[model samples]
Target: MPSSSGQCTCLRPFLLGSLLMLGFLLLLFTYINPNMDSPSLGMYFRPAPSCSHWANQDNSTLESDNETHHTTVLIWKWPFQYKFDSDCGVFGVQKCYLTDDRSIYNKADGVFFHHLDIHLGDLPKIPRPCFQKWVWTNMESPDNVPRKPWLDDLFNLTCNYRLDANIPVPYGYLVPRNSEDPDFQLPTKDQLVCWIVSNWNRNLLRVQYYNRLKDHLQISSYGKAFGKPLSEEDNKKVVSSCKFYLAFENSVHKDYITEKLFRPMSLGSVPVVLGPPRDSYLRHIPGDSFIHVNDFASPKELADRLHHLSKNPEEYMRYFRWTKESKMTISWFGKEHACRTCGYIQKHRKSIEVLDSTASSQPPHGLLTASSRPPHGLLTASSRPPHGLLTASSRPPHGLLTASSRPPHGALKS
Candidate 1:
């Protein structure tokens, strides 16, 4: 037999070889299958796809040709589909394509829907795994859409850009003073006051107010609910002829002002707005530009004021001064809205979820009063918000994986 020293030397080589093999496996395991349970490793193991790099290489481009390079936005609603090329980019470079093809819904960069049209309960689950989902609602009021707890968690963005005055409407809608046009002249007076109402019975408050106003003075009414519907041009001409137009909303809500207020304001007629509180209007429009129904003690008083304005051309024309100095733009809610959707998706590239209570904590200008919250049963378990559930912030919530680390919120319904 070999000496004890030789045996010890041979054994050392074998033991050393075994130790090296074992160390190699441990290193390979650490690299190939990381400990996902570790908080630090969790992020590294399952990294989120960067939103900016998701489509830019293929679908998205900085090119002016929208046809060649544009982010596709699927419209779930057929009637309210926003398809016109408003070219809403930093410098007229088209970047959004709003479509309605189910085939593209999953692949679409975003999905768009209106509050009045969609009901989430019926859908059961989101139709497609879109990168973003947008809801457009200008109709939610204390009496209409209820505030749901999940709204902040559901939608990725709010298509209701109307509430912000900084976002200008379509270019064609802004009717600036045409001093150069020989045909242009001061709007001639026609009816004392006009209301292009379609909801005659659904809203008892509106119908009751209309009746009370009529008791004092005559107010012409048009639309299927009252009379024959006027054409767009005819409606504009009629509103322009009138001294005042009732821009009452179906229901009152903060920042719920709609085209009812804007159309009359654009046409040089004083708008008697009745949707949001007067303060909300002041934020977006001149305080003197509109007459708030709440400001009047009674319908008779409102009618009297309207009558007085109709008689005094100088007093009535004062409402037009804001328009004279700075032209008012009306959003072609359809096309301009689509442009905004595109512009938003193109710029923002991050995963996020907004918290409702925080997001809707304040209105565009102020806090939500107790009256703004819906009464019990306004939001049922099965109740589907017409505009979907949540509105999103442009930035990603810090530590997006953790619910508690969510970013601050924004508004919905309004």
Candidate 2:
């Protein structure tokens, strides 16, 4: 119906108009959605990056100045694995990703290793840079672990994951209604002294001490290390029923307090603690709360004190006084543990520099023993937030007290 020139002229404006509209829309998207890299709007159409992908991306973009923004920690060894979902953020640190592949060790800001599982054959050959922190963690003290001269100088931070560690990963429980409220009535406990030991002869000193203590008084025993197997519930019930529980350590080392102390304290039992100096325990526990074995010259004398307390319920109840304000539960494991490790790194990676000092050299501050508690403190709490009882509510979400949680990485592992 029209000439060829007229037809071409009519189509040119429509094509040009369509292209202009498309160009304008692309420009708008590029401005609003910074993630859209391609000229095609695939970012708008495609799904968001999965956690692993995001972690990979994070590793690629870890600017030296922006250490606070990244959140990936590598578990360098087995026995402990990062168990949380990729999206769960704890204490403000996001879980960008976690991997067992040690090849990507540099990608992570922190590297975690269970001291028990750490071996010379399995160690990473690469020296970790200052930005990368190595966490020296273990449930046992130095005495418990086999001699590894190389391990003495391998960590940027220490986690005494057991109850009395620098990070004090003590167990937690719901505070009792009566304990917290002065008006609520206190419950009466029935049983006498009990010991739930699973290792019979592991610690010769502990074995010798327990044998001597049992000679003076009737000590009910349970667990594989002693009497028999008990379920978690039954064990708790047993401990709760007892008036006193032997919260004895396998080996006596400075601040090597373990669940033995925490379990009894949480279950309303007066813990007859037999590790560390009384003053060291004083740092974590209320002085009046438990009886220290060191307080008495011998196991028999300790037995006599327990005997007197059992007859005197009013006196026995004094041990529960501290429970009103503080509740003791169990240490976290799996993902929760990983979250804590990650959060600790995000907060401290910038400040803490890993030093491979020999045992003879001066060890890091904060990680010093009870001998240093009176005067010398960890590096200096100047860089950290104020510390509190190891409750989620008490600890500052951003940073942890260096003095409280940085016990010497190289210590007896009882």
Candidate 3:
């Protein structure tokens, strides 16, 4: 109502002041609001709980336990020894010392030949019948051989361990032609038959005839006598290509589940197992994962099953699905930590009362006992120390001590 210029000036200052007040209010609201996102805020100033602190604490505890409970185990070196070795911290028996001399077996040969003896004599605590090797035919005579007593003693000492060493495959090896091809190359049906005819032995024929099978079914062998050894990678590829594999055991013994069964099953191939009763082998593997020769009344019956399975891809694929869905991870050899011998030792360490009378009932003469207070704090939780800390105890807490305490990894020596 006064001058137009005066009114315009009044509105300008008012608008400016209002905008400034609105910005100031917004800043104040942001500072007070707990839910507001502020990128500039320091982590320490934040009100939220620190998950990093908890994680660090957990990791620290694990490290501490690992530092405390380290153990070193001495093992006999052998090429065929598939038992766990503590030094490698891996599963499977590794060949440490190889030798050409047959007269005096090195640690490996000694362990291989006298496995039962050493185990029985309490010199070695490994499980019985540790490998899948053919016993020299000359040594098969049960006559006045010293090995008989050793076997008998081992049997008497530990009925808990299984001693069967069946060869699932009779000098069988796989070789893959090409892997990347959608239609991977496999041995032709005719080629397989021809190979079998050339390589079949009297023993092998006996197995075929005893099983009452067809002569027309395609079968082949990569013979050991011929020395056509398939490389490890080729073996894996062959398994992947094949729908079925023959898992022939070297010997027929009770409760022996060999790699012939394990490898094929692991590679998503259905195994045609030729060892032990179906029930015995199932103890080690998932039921329905394999087809046993004994399951079929005749060779035709077995062949029919195989043919039907091959034609029906859905059913055949089910076997592999079961393996995957179950998340089963099978190892051809036992883990370093899985030595039945070491397992026994760990179990008895706390329960051992006296060294003399408390010796393991099976093999290896050491007796362990559980004490309210173990010597050298071996049995106590304090035996474990922080990681990188020297002078830590070998005994680590196996379980979480409390909400405030946790054990470290690599803490135990096993």
Candidate 4:
């Protein structure tokens, strides 16, 4: 055995040597090792690039692509939610609108369906089976009542419409012209003036409501209040010359389809619609197809977007890409339908037949039980089908409702 002092001295050297070796190992692992599993021991680390760099790159790519491609548009007049016949329109015209039965045969321009449903809604529940489907929000009879209760049933039966698909029409309405000729002479600014023709007081009410827009843009207003109906020549000139037009509806309503949205696009003028959220309109129309009052954060913000478009003719003309391909028009309830959503319905004849078969095959007890239960969460808020029309009191929050629940239609008596 060693002396106490000697033993202590020996232990001190051993302990100190072990600690030094451990420290060396830690340092080596931390600074030099690339494959170290320990986070603190990793050899390389760096911060992410700034948002501005990513944004700039994205914007540059968008600008370059836009310059190279031509944009095409299909017009539809039916409500955005209705799915009807598919075989009646252009090859791709399944997505375009039709003015009349005759327009389906004329596809010299590109296809023009009423709306495009880019977002695919719930597959199992939507009445029409398609890879994609638009909503036909505009379909209304002469009395302005929706012609079909099936539409109401669809809204009541599915949360699928909202969750699976974005609204189909860009704006609730669109303007299209008869002539597809690109060289067609548009009206001059001096020849064209603001025009409104409606029996409803709401038309003038909106005029007064949005007077500031007229003043800022220096546009002139004329109609029954100002004078006679603008002549065809004058109307053509007015549309051709003016950069923008006011496409106010007689009444404010959700998913109300009107000619106001259509006439502006027809004449190559930007229509500024005064109802619903801009997103609601975009659900049906192409991106940047029309201007919505809701798009502006404020009235002043709306003025700014208008001013930008006014100054930039190229930007304003960009909207014409959808219209110029074909002078598509909206067709109502004929054998041939113009709306893409409607076409999708027509295309899936087999699936609809299957649904009918399944319903028929179900035992009477099961059918009765299913009918007694309320529509699934998907069908809430939407108008009741003919079989089960839920009253306004029964309408569910965030659920689908019939176009009848939509504004002007809602006001109409059932």
The candidate that achieves the highest TM-score relative to the unseen native structure: 2
Residues 240-345, candidate 3, lDDT per residue (tens digit)? 5577777765445454344456555555567777766888765555666777888878778888888787778678666654433332223212222223223222
Off by more than 4 A, model 4: 1-138, 141-187, 191-193, 202-208, 231-234, 297-301, 304-308, 311-315, 318-335, 338-414
Q: Which 10 residues in a row give candidate 3 its minimum summed lDDT? A: 132-141
Kindly provide the TM-score of model 2 when superposed on the true structure, using C-alpha atoms: 0.65
Residue-by-residue lDDT tens digits, candidate 4, 293-343: 766666667767777876786886687677553353332322222333333
Best by lDDT: 2
lDDT for each residue of candidate 1 in 156-196, tens digit (9 for 90 to 100)? 45555334311222212233334542332458876888888
Per-residue lDDT of 188-235 in model 2, one digit per residue for the tens?
Answer: 667788888666674467778888898999888888775487866788
> lDDT score, residue 227, model 2?
49
Q: lDDT scores for all predictions?
A: 0.53, 0.57, 0.36, 0.39
Using all chains and alpha carbons, the TM-scores for the candidates as numbered come to 0.59, 0.65, 0.44, 0.40
TM-score order of candidates, best first? Answer: 2, 1, 3, 4
Regions of model 2 farther than 4 Å from truth: 1-68, 80-98, 101-103, 125-130, 161-188, 334-337, 357-414
Model 2 per-residue lDDT at 236 = 79
Per-residue error (Å), model 4, residue 207: 4.2
User: What are the clash counts of all predictions, listed in order?
Assistant: 7, 18, 33, 68
Please state every model's RMSD to the true fold in angstroms.
Answer: 14.0, 10.3, 22.8, 23.9
